[model samples]
Target: MPNSLSARTWVIAATGLAPLTWGSTYAVTTEFLPPDRPLFTGLVRALPAGLVLLGIARTLPRGQWWWRSAVLGLLNIGAFFPLLFFAAYRLPGGVAAVLNAGAPLFAAVFALVLLAERVSARTLLAGFAGVLGVALVVLRGDAHLDLLGVLAGAAGTASMSAGTVMTKRWGRPPCTSVLTMSGWQLTAGGVFLLPVALLVEGAPPALDGRAITGYLYLALVNTALAYWLWLRGIGRLPATSVSFLGLLSPLSATLIGWVALGQALTPLQIAGMVVAFGSTIVGQAVAGRRSPVRSVPVAARGGTGVTNEPVNGR
Candidate 1:
């Protein structure tokens, strides 16, 4: 039991790293990447990372995973990137982030329906509090709402939430390592994005040194490694606990903007960050106290836990 708890804690902390890396994306995109080419940018992030992981894993999806990988890829990456970018374009300030902060709620609902996992009141409240905190940190008083942007943001949030729950629902095949599974999804997502990017944005933008560096960083670190960790977590942790970790992205963005980009944070923003961080911590704690919520029965899972657990943390 102690070992199980330790293993679970380590998985949570490692998975938490994904969102932290993702938080830096706004800073990298604004400062380094070319502007107004979201689809192309997303393509760069997904395709290269996917291919690299696939090369390393040297495994291909078999049987149902081919279609399952495609569906997961579209939900988690291909569709998500475009919709999120669309919301970012249409929505002002941090409105998109605020909407996305509700992901825990979506994940909770989906977990209940799809996985038959029970939602605790504390987790639900934490989800709402996280939203309020994100709004405080990102949403500017002058920010105006666009109806289309709201829809896009909501859709993106739902897509990812559903994807997360589904990933938890369908544990990886016994023969496939998490790395290979991640590669499959990334590759499929990138393939899906290719024509869309070409059609919507025309030719890819010319890249300077900084742009190239940015793309490499995003592809290698942010999307590839980060998502590998995220999907691994979905395999190990409760869907809701993993979703709450996403709240860190906005908080991370706020901090990066403040430290790296010299963006100002108001008192309220600081407080909001505190609240959001608190909610994430509390959600994890609550989840820890509960019994492991199995998306699959023990016999089908080929026994308990991922064999390769990262060094323990948080």
Candidate 2:
């Protein structure tokens, strides 16, 4: 369905909420969750949340949806979630967020190759500015650079980027509700992580009150519910616009750090925020002017492949 004015407003508001919830993750991790068991925490976050959503949706995907959902789940949630937690464990919150900021650039690249979408020079330059802004915000006096952490963050970003492009390319089946579609991916991702969690983390660790609460919040609010809203927006909005909204995740984290965690922001961090926010605006404006690329008809390509289109805007 084309987005109505109210739908557009709702999606924009919902998009804002997803990132704000994401931002609290850093503070929650440090203050509440067990520090050494990042993978375990990720597993908990994905699995339980997935189960809950699946239960609510109570709809199994039909036909090839099973396979498609599984693939999307791995990229969007399974691999991305664990890798993101690993990055958080190894790096500072700001640093991890900064690295993740590269996701849009990665998305653009994947769109070009996988979806046959074209990238404008302006979008490419904006991508660089976004990365630079993230660098300015997170990299401090050379103290925060860790090669391993950076690599992990990059991997996580790539996973999510690939997922985003795939989502846009494939869209969703007509019979599926947004909730079911999201539930399928989350459940698939959770299932994928379960064995890994068992082998790696083994059993659950002793949890303090804070850790328990944090896990619940991450599972319920951040993973399950936030994902529903995000996917809903993604389905309705343009891909580029959806990707740009991701900037709010880091920006929200920065604010949460300052207000909730009392983490001090440097002057450079402030500057970085301005640039990052600016890049988002610039990207959106440029994207708005261009018409979406028409994908090869699904019939022309075997039903197995996806046709790429421009990201949806409300």
Candidate 3:
């Protein structure tokens, strides 16, 4: 039991690297990457990473998985990435972050309906707390909300929420590693974005040293490694619990802005951070209690196995 608990804790922390790293994306995109080329940016973030992972894994989707991978990719990355970038471009950073913080609520609903997972009151409360906390930390009263950006944010959140539940439902192909699965999704998403980016944004922007460094960081560490960890977490933890970890993205972004960009952190923002982080803790604890700890098999731990569905049977 102790081992099981420890293993779960480790997985949770490792999985968290996804959102935590993602927090830096706003800074990177604004500072280093080309300006106003969201689709192209999304393309760079996903495609190269996908190709690299596919090469390393030496695996392709087989049978129904060919289409399944495409669908999941469209929802999670293809749609989510473009929309996320679009929203970021159209909206204030704080507004965009607050909109994204609503993802846990979307995940909770999707889990109940699609995955047949029961929603607990505590989890629901925690979800609300997460939203409020993020609002406090990042949202500014003077921030203007663009209608299109708001819609994009909502759509992106819903798209990824559905994807998260579906990923939990479909699990991965038998005997496939998380690396291969991530490759399939990332490649599909990149492919989907290709024509759209070209048509909407014209040719790619000129790359400088800073741009290259930013893309490399985003592709290798942010997208590839982070997504591998996230999908693995979805396979191990409850969908809603995994979604709750997304709160860290906004928190990470706000802190980065304050520390790296020299933006001021008001006392209210600090309190909001406490609230958001506290809610994440409560949500995870509630989820863990609901999901009784059991020993994870050796195969699941190795990242090469079937039956890598959520441990709570979500």
1-314, model 2: which lDDT tens digit per residue?
34434445565577667776987877888889886777787788787887887788788888888999999999998899888877876886467877888877888888778766567888888878888887787676644767898898899999998888787667776556677878899889988988888788888788888889999999999888888888876655556666777887777778788888888988888999899889887776676555343343443323433333333322
Candidate 1 lDDT tens digits, 1-314 = 67777777778899999999999999999999999999999999999999999999998988888898999999999999999999999999889999999999999999889877778889899999999999999998789999999999999999999999888777777667889989999999999999999999999889999999999999999999999999988877888889999999988888999999999989999999999999999988887776442234423434333434221122
lDDT of 1: 0.88
- Model 3 clashes, total count: 0
- In candidate 3, residue 274 scores what lDDT? 99
Regarding TM-score, does 1 or 2 come out ahead? 1
Q: Which regions of candidate 1 deviate over 4 angstroms?
A: 292-314
Tens digits of lDDT, candidate 3, 1-314: 68767877887899898999999998998999988888888899899999999999999888888999999999999999888877877888477778888888999999988767788999999999999999999888778989999999889999998898888777775678889999999999999999999999998988999999999999999999999999999888888989999999999988999999998999999999999999999988888876644534435434224553345544
lDDT of each: 0.88, 0.76, 0.87
Model 1 — TM-score against the truth? 0.94
